[model samples]
Target chain A: MLARRVIPCLDVDKGRVVKGTKFVNLTDEGDPAELAERYAREGADEIVFLDITAAHEGRATMLDVVRRTASRAFVPLTVGGGVRSVQEMHDVLRAGADKVSFNTAAVAAPELLTACAERFGSQAVVCAIDARRLPRTDGAGQTWEVVTHGGRRATDLDAVSWALRVVELGAGELLVTSIDRDGTRSGFDTELLASIASRVRVPVIASGGASSPEDFVTAVRDGKADAVLAASIFHRRMHSIASVKAAMAAAGLPVRPVGEAVA
Target chain B: MTGSKPRIAILDYGAANLVSITHGLAAVGADVVVAAEPSALAGADALVVPGVGAAASAMTHLRERGLVEPLRNWVRAGKPCLGICLGFELLFDASDEGDAETLGFLAGRTVALRDAPTLPHIGWNVVRAVRPHPLFDGIPDGSYFYFVHSFAPVPADEGVVVARTDHGRPFVSAVARGSLYGLQFHPEKSSDAGLRLLSNFLRLVAANAETNARAGAALGSEVA
Candidate 1:
């Protein structure tokens, strides 16, 4: 059986980890490689580096960051944000990233998913859907609308339908972030996650509103997510990965124990 | 073998990513080289064929890079070689994916993993060893390794299979015979156990070289 993955997501700008880490232990929290290695040592199942860089030079620097991180961390890494083309995706993968995730680009050109998947296999292609819950009108219950650019813009495409479409477009994995719950510390939008996870055949990684280890458990049990990703909670050290995995294990879900002996 | 680093050459035949494997080996104390040409494999203690993608396209890249025969010959010589992911698939007689014929170093056909709930079984899964091998030295009986694949080889000779993993059904996850070893999972991305496994492989490479050196010395003594 596969163990549920716990990933720590980092935002990189200008090739540096964008200054949210409150690790008093780390000498240079801005260094992605250093921070990533620390997280891997702490038993992070995977590491995600979202390139929030906007400058052209930032792109080259992000590649360098990935190269350095892969050299040291030795865990599966998914790089998302600002990857727009097959060539760009190729560059990121070649730089030592295990997977390349697309969000805005994928929404703008869904064919990019097919192209990248065809070129690198579906296993290397990840689609990130940022969705904001729509208000229920006329007893419609609740539905989510696809949002992009960190929920700043909304697309008319329904989240569930877009998820199915992205899967059809050859995205091997889906990173579903609930914009409504993001940064709210309210908990994951399990309804939103289940709606998409149940519909998609590929793995769904739940993100947004992870404030505690119980949230991680809920993300898996209720949201039906194959993996759980969080940023602030982990970065702020409010909850450790070990605690989250322990919670999941206590909840009867499979999770790799921290400090598991290789022998 | 004792004092110097064992040089391991990684074959680069248009695989999606070779950097991780290169760094993985380097971090494990092996002298790593990203070799794209046959001549580049010279003087190296081992050749590692690492790749991820469709079998047909992989074979094409190997053919285009003139690596098909070199890789087969490397295995034929009983030299230390490791095949990873798609490279592992390429070792079989054929692949069900794209109906591609692969390097027939091993007697098997790469087929879709039976009864898999997911088309691409991607994640950390248990790798249960079937028999003892140095390749898994110090590694636990059922260590979780990261895997991302749809098909696994069905070896005609089950004796060669060293480990198995299940998605919906059991499938060969690792294999060992002679000087060759193969893994379906990406050890480079499997964290600590992976690094440990690579360290063990390097030790095996050094051990294999020592045995060969001793055999050569014995043969020279006889000739003398």
Candidate 2:
């Protein structure tokens, strides 16, 4: 009876929180630490801070941000994007991040996942897979391909198959993002999510397209996802964590109630 | 220090998450200390073992710090002790992760949850009590606990297993024997259910102290 998690993702650029529409045309939201504290106080189960500027700057500012946020957040914080080396991962953990996520680094080296998992426990390592659906090339088939570099580069790797590989490499969780449906506010791709969840035994965190609390419920109930991550709905004040939990409860999904009241 | 707050020592074997564990215990009003020295464990009315990482590495750290025998002696002396996650696995005789040897205080072996419906069993799942234990006191039957592990201990003695959770099959989730209690879930991360469990654990510590005082008084009277 673990409650399903409702995560709010913060895209950080130049040490500030920013929200982009369709992964472009970014608009500054607020200070990263302030936003994180607000979400934590509002009952967010966990907070994800992505250093979108890491790749461009060739360095990570997320660690400092993580340290400042961790000092006050009082909840689990996951820092991702541009985490390329073991040193970087270690720095993030030392900065008080409960978990460190990898994107380009994990795909490029692959063994980096195993190394990180070995040095730091698997529970500390998360593999973020950005995927997009591709048209059938073999005459009567359609599939999703794993994309890297902020969903710009498309690899021949199948999303489901790569998910299994990463788990085998000792990834504790899979953060699967559907590039096709990202920021659409249309809801998660239920079929795609279910397919991935059925393939892997690790917890699947559905990301990319979530407009309503119903989207979260669908992702957990039908998609069988352990949690759901949303940016737009949460960033734009479209929904709150309390409302999402209420909706999930109404949908018959077991969710942790707000406030501390022992059951 | 009588009638004052009972001092709780959290054994830091170099590989555990002491910060979070200490924070959680403090949130419940427990006087918590991250004890790294053998002498610190001496005056504690209760002990907490919080761990992360491989079994072999954890054991190595414990042994290097001369904590193995002291921990066993503390529990044997009937001091209340609670182990969380990796701490639970370390209480077993052996683990499949890395090396086979373990603390061997508990009669069980830790095996990988490979064939389980889900590996790593992350997030929350309802834990059902199979036996009556003080740890589950005041908590409901199907209370959920937060878990994140790929391996769990299966105690040899069925009576020692206090709770079981079904991920694919019903497996042991919590265990209690005498004063030694271990939880496979991260109670610090388990929300209210976790806080209630910690409260019950504190009660057990108080009860143990009272029993110890009575025994000491009886011994003194016998000498007289």
Candidate 3:
């Protein structure tokens, strides 16, 4: 059986980690590679580098960061952000990323996903869907609208349908983020997750609003997420990855023990 | 052969990503070369065939680069060779995915993982050793390694099987026969356990080179 992955996401901008973290042992905590290595040592199943760099020049720096991260951290890496073309995705993969996620660009031009998937396998293509809960109207139980640019803009597309569309468009995986619950620490939007995850054939990674280890359990049990991703909790040392896995393991979820996979 | 690092040729058919695998081989103290041409396999102690995506297209790329025969010859010559992921699938006779005939170094065929809950089976999964081998020297049985594929090979020769991992059902994860090795998992992306496996492979290649050298010296002649 596949072990449910517990991933720590780092927001990178211009080759540096966006969120400030102060680890006691490291000299340069801002360096994405150093932090990623630390997280891997702490038993992060995989590392997600969300390259939020806005400027064009910063893209090169992110590639360097990916290179440095790959050299230091031997874990699977997925880089998302600013990848618009097949060539750009190629650059990230050549820079040592195992997978690349598409968000805004994928929404604008969905054929990008197919083209990228054809060049690189669908296994290497990931579609990140940011969704926000829409208010109940006409006695509807629940609904979500697709959002882009970090949940600032909303598209007319329904989140559930969009997920299926992306998969059909050749996305191997879906990173479903709840814009409504992002950074809220309330919990994951299980309703939103279930809607898409249950429908799509690809694995769905639940993102946003993860504060505790139990939240991860619910994400899988309720949302039916194949993997769970969180940022601040692991970053701020609020909770250790071991604790999260312990919680999951206690809940009868299969999890890889930290520091046990290595010799 | 005693102290010198082993040279490895990683066949690049262009589409498959070679970054992590290349860095991984180098990190394991093996001199790495991303060889795109048949002549690039020269002077290398071992060859690594790393690929992903469709078998037909992958086979096409190898054919276009004129690497098909050399790869088969390299394995037929019994030089140390390792194939990762799709490269593992290509070891078989044919694939159901692309309906394409692959390199039949081993007797088998690639098929969709039976009863798989997930299509891609993308994540860390436990690889249980069916038999002991030097490739798993330091790695423990049931250790998790990163995997990203939907199809797995059913080996015709069960004697070559080294490890089996279950996603839906038990599937061959690692195989070893003579100097040939095939892993369905990506050691390059498997973190620590992965690096250790690659290190062990390097050691295996180095040891084989030594054994060959000693045999040549006993014959009182160098084959080359």
Candidate 4:
């Protein structure tokens, strides 16, 4: 059986990690590499860095940050935010990102998904979907509408249908994030996750609104997520990854112990 | 044979994760080189065929660089070699992926994993070493390693299979025959278990070199 992965996400801006990432052991609080290395030591199965910088010059700086982080952390790194072109994807992967997540770019041009998957393998392409539940205009109960550009813009694309198309377009992994439940600390939108997980054949990573260890359990058990990704919960020191892994293990889930996999 | 550092050549055929593999090798104190030309691999103490792309493209890249025959000869001579992921798939005769013709170093056919609940089989899964080998020297059985692939090789000879894992059903996770080694999992990205596996490979290369040196010295002494 595959072990359920626990990932800690860092929101980076101008080559610096932002959003209250003030862990004590870290020498440079702004440095993404130091934070990533700390997370790796804490047994984060993977680390994601979302570069929120919008400037052209800032993108190069983010790539440098990515290169440094990749050198420091041995685990798989997934970099997203402002990834619009295949050249940018190549630059990130060449800087040592194992996978590149495309949300805004993928929605704008669905063929970009196919193109990147062709240049790089599908395993290198991660289709990140940010969805928000909306009241069904068609007399139905509700529907998860796909949103892009940091969840500010909504599209007509249905969440479930988009997931199937991305998989068909050769995306190896699907990262479904719920915009409504994000940073709410309420819990994961397992309903959103369950809908996508059932439709896609690739590994689904449930992101946003992960407040508790049980929330992770629900994400895996009820939502059927292959992995759970969180930002503020782990970054704010609410719970350590080891404690979460322990809780998951107690709940009869398989997890890798920190520092035990190495010699 | 002459230097203290073990020269390990990682065959570069436009593989995606070349940087990580090189970094993993560097962590184990092995001198790593990314060889695009076949000549660069000739003097290597061990050759690693690191791959991450599709089968047909991987084959095309290797052929374009004129590396097919040299890799075949290297394996035939029984020098230490290792393959990772798509590199492992390329060791077989053929693959269902793009109808690719592989190196055929191992007598097997690579096919799509049957009844897979997931397509790529991503994430970490336990791999159990079925037979004792130096490749798994310090690693424990049923240890988790990261794997990302839809196709797996079915070796013609079962004896080559040293480790087995399952995503949907049981499949060959690691195969070893003398100096030739292949692993479907990515040891570089697998955290500690992965580093340990790469460390073990480095040790194997050193051990193989020492044995060959001793044999050569003895033969020279007899001739003298």
Measured by TM-score, the strongest candidate is: 1
Best by DockQ: 1
lDDT (tens digit, per residue) of candidate 4 on A81-192: 8888888888888788889998898998989989988888898899999999988687675579999876788899999999999999979999999999887889999999
Give the per-residue lDDT digits (tens) of candidate 3, residues B37-155: 99999988999999878888999999999999999899998999999999989988999987999999999999988888887889999999999999998898899999999899999
Badly placed stretches (over 4 Å) of model 4 are A20-28, A136-139, A261-263, B1-3
Across A102-201, the per-residue lDDT of candidate 2 in tens digits comes to 8778888899999988877888889999989988787655578999987789888988889889989978899989888887778898777888898887
Predicted candidate 1 versus true structure: per-residue lDDT over B26-108, tens digit per residue = 99899988899889988889999898889999888889998888887889999999999988888889999999999999999
Error of 2 at A237 (Å): 3.1
Model 4 clashing residue pairs (backbone) = A261-B192, A261-B193, A262-B192
By TM-score, the better pick of 1 and 4 is: 1
- Prediction 4 global C-alpha lDDT: 0.88
Task: Report the Cα lDDT for residue A147, model 2.
Answer: 94
Q: How many collisions between residues are there in candidate 2?
A: 4
Candidate 1 residue lDDT tens string, A33-149? 999999999999999998877777788899999999988998899999889999999999999998999999999999999999999999999999999988889967789999988
Task: Tell me how far the alpha carbon of residue A113 in candidate 1 is from the true structure, in angstroms, after superposition.
Answer: 0.6
Q: Residue by residue across B22-137, what tens digits does model 4's lDDT show? A: 88888877889989898888678999998876899899989999999999999998999999999999999999899998999899999989988887888889999889988887
Binned by DockQ into CAPRI classes (incorrect, acceptable, medium, high), candidate 4 is: medium
Scoring each candidate complex against the real one, what DockQ results? 0.80, 0.32, 0.72, 0.68
True contacts kept of each: 0.84, 0.35, 0.76, 0.62
lDDT of 4 at B89: 91
Please list the residue runs of candidate 2 whose C-alpha ends up more than 4 Å from where it truly belongs after superposition. A1-4, A12-45, A53-76, A94-96, A138-140, A246-260, B1-3, B213-224
